[model samples]
Target: MKVAPLPDDEAQRLAALRGYGVLDSEPEADFDELTRFASELCGTPIALVSLVDAGRQWFKSRVGLDAAETPRDVAFCAHAILQRGVFEVEDASADPRFADNPLVAAAPSIRFYAGAPLVNADGFPLGTLCVIDRVPRSLDALQRHGLEVLGRQVIAQLELRRKLADLARARDQALAGVRAKDVFLATMGHELRTPLGGILGLSELLLEGPAGGQDGVADDLRAIQRAGSHLLEVVEDILGLAQLELDQPRLRPRRFDLDELLADVEATVRPLLRGRAVALNVGRSPTPVEADPTRVRQIVYNLVANAIRFTERGSVDVTVAREGDTLAVRVRDTGVGIPREKLALLFRDFSQVHGDHEAELRGTGLGLAISRRYARLMGGDIVAESEPGRGSTFTLTLPLAPAT
Candidate 1:
């Protein structure tokens, strides 16, 4: 018996076949359907979608067959894969290469065989779509063409399977990376907060001590306090963002007067308007809300502070109203308005919209992003409407009751 020799690109062909990840897999209906069609079209009792491996040719799908695989040395599909087109033996018993082969002499007793090479996109033949008969016979031209067409479909399925697996792996990797980043941020934020708090405390004590009567020493100490305070604010923003991203912020909901909450927020940010010509006007009715007052206060404070930062000489207005089951808080600023194109970027982490005139007021840029996250966590959202020179208005809407 003559054993079939390997193809010229045997190493690459084996690599390509393995890359599909089809070896030794259980039968799937898609492949089984094609195998059945091949058997029916070729008028054969046995058909298989075979994949060639290093030592064996495994059947991915088979019809009228009990064994899942055969040795490569005795596999007709192995020899068939060396050709770009179908390889046929009118009678395997008469062909020197397969006449003495165990597969032909015993068991299934193959006498006739025809196979179409399963070629991949890169022109490497992985295996074959084959049909076997117990009696000597030959397939007509039409049957041969059908078999080749089905072989291409098998390659298509393999490509699709590989692509889907690749996409799933990428998705998992991206999620893992995001989780790692959140962990790193949370860790660093905690580590840096301790020293920053110490620096601010020491600077304040020095400013109120004997240094207060000194010439330029007090100013330097005050500057140190300001820088430390700003750094502390940045650290806090980072910590807040990390917590929100990790889904760790627990809302403490209670029934409270939203007007009083707005009043408190107004008082908190009024100090920010001390030196600026911007007018802070808060208009709200006596409305009661059942939600976390602290978080609500944070969101409103962020919006008001953001408006104040942008408006140089105009006014920042805050208004509140109840709409059905939701409450809307709008902060409008008469500063240099954000461009329409830049509006969508307002709520993205580390993203800030900067106009030519507002460049000097650049901040940590986490306020809006964190605020929106907080809003959504409570079943709400924040939206913006603005015209470049006419100024911008930001509206924060939340459910009146905490979402169950």
Candidate 2:
């Protein structure tokens, strides 16, 4: 018996087959179903969707068969893939090439064989869809056509699966990139806080020391202290925002008097307003609301602090009220107004909007973002309304009661 020779484009065909990345893959229901259906249609006891590897012909889908693969030199499917159309042998024992083949001489003896090459779009035969019958017989015209159609279907399935796998890989990579960015920001917060603490500590110690009127030393130390203090706050804000971004922030919610909360915030902010031309207006909010008190306080504090930072000579007003089913806390500032176009960026992390001189206001730009998140975690949201010259108003709206 003579062994079947390789195709003229053997190297190209093998490369094209390997490019599919489907060899030794787990069996799929679609391919298996097609194989079983083909077996029934062709009146054969065995059917397979086979892939021709470099050293073996692997069965991707099989019916009425036990062996998963066979040596390429002895595989009838290997010879079938080399043909352009259906390759049929009425009787394998009468064919010189397969008569002495172990597959025909031993178990799963192939007497009547018919296969259609599974050709890819690139015109490479990667494998075949074949049927085998133990008795010597020939396939009818309709059966041969049906087998070839099923072979093309197998190629279509393989191509579709490859595309889906590529998309899944891309999605995983994008998610990984976002995780790495968040982790990097968190790590930098800790790294920045160390130097900021050292600078703040050293500057405070120097300021408290008795000076020899050392030229610019006193003024320099004061500037350092202010910068260090701002940097420390920014670092803390970064750390806090990172925590909120990466995980959920815990809320210790409780029932509290809205007016008393505003009073406490007024006392804390009044000391900062002492020497400034700005006025702190706390409208009467004699209403009680049920919510997380600490998170609510944090949200209000951040807004008030932000207003104070931007307003140089105008009043900063705070008002709280329960309107229907919602609680509204509005912070209005008469400092520098926000631009209409930059309003969309007000709550974005690491975003600062000071108009053309936006660069002058410095701190961790994470305050608004963190505040918004804190509000939402308690089932609320913050919105801003501003005109370029009329100043800005930030409103924090929350549900009056938690969802049951």
Q: Score every model by TM-score.
A: 0.75, 0.80
lDDT of each: 0.85, 0.83
Q: Can you write out model 2's per-residue Cα lDDT over 162-243, one digit (the tens) per residue? A: 8898888898998798689777876897688888888877876776677515648977886776677667667778778767
**Model 1 poorest ten-residue lDDT run:** 355-364
Give each model's clash number. Answer: 0, 3
Which ten contiguous residues of candidate 2 have the minimum total lDDT?
267-276
Q: Pairing residues by index, what is the TM-score of model 2? A: 0.80
Q: Which residue ranges in model 1 land beyond 4 Å of their true spot?
A: 197-221, 235-260, 263-286, 289-295, 306-361, 365-404
Global Cα RMSD, each model:
5.1, 4.2
Candidate with best lDDT? 1
* Residue-wise C-alpha lDDT for candidate 1, range 1-404, written one tens digit per residue: 77679888899888888888778777788888999999999999999998888889999999999999999989998889877789999999999898899998998999999999999989998889999999999999999999999999988988998898799989899889878988788689878988888887787678668986796997787667657756776787877887776666799877676777788888877746745899999997666666678888888888887788778888999888889888888999998788888988988889978854565577788988898888887778899999877778999887775444
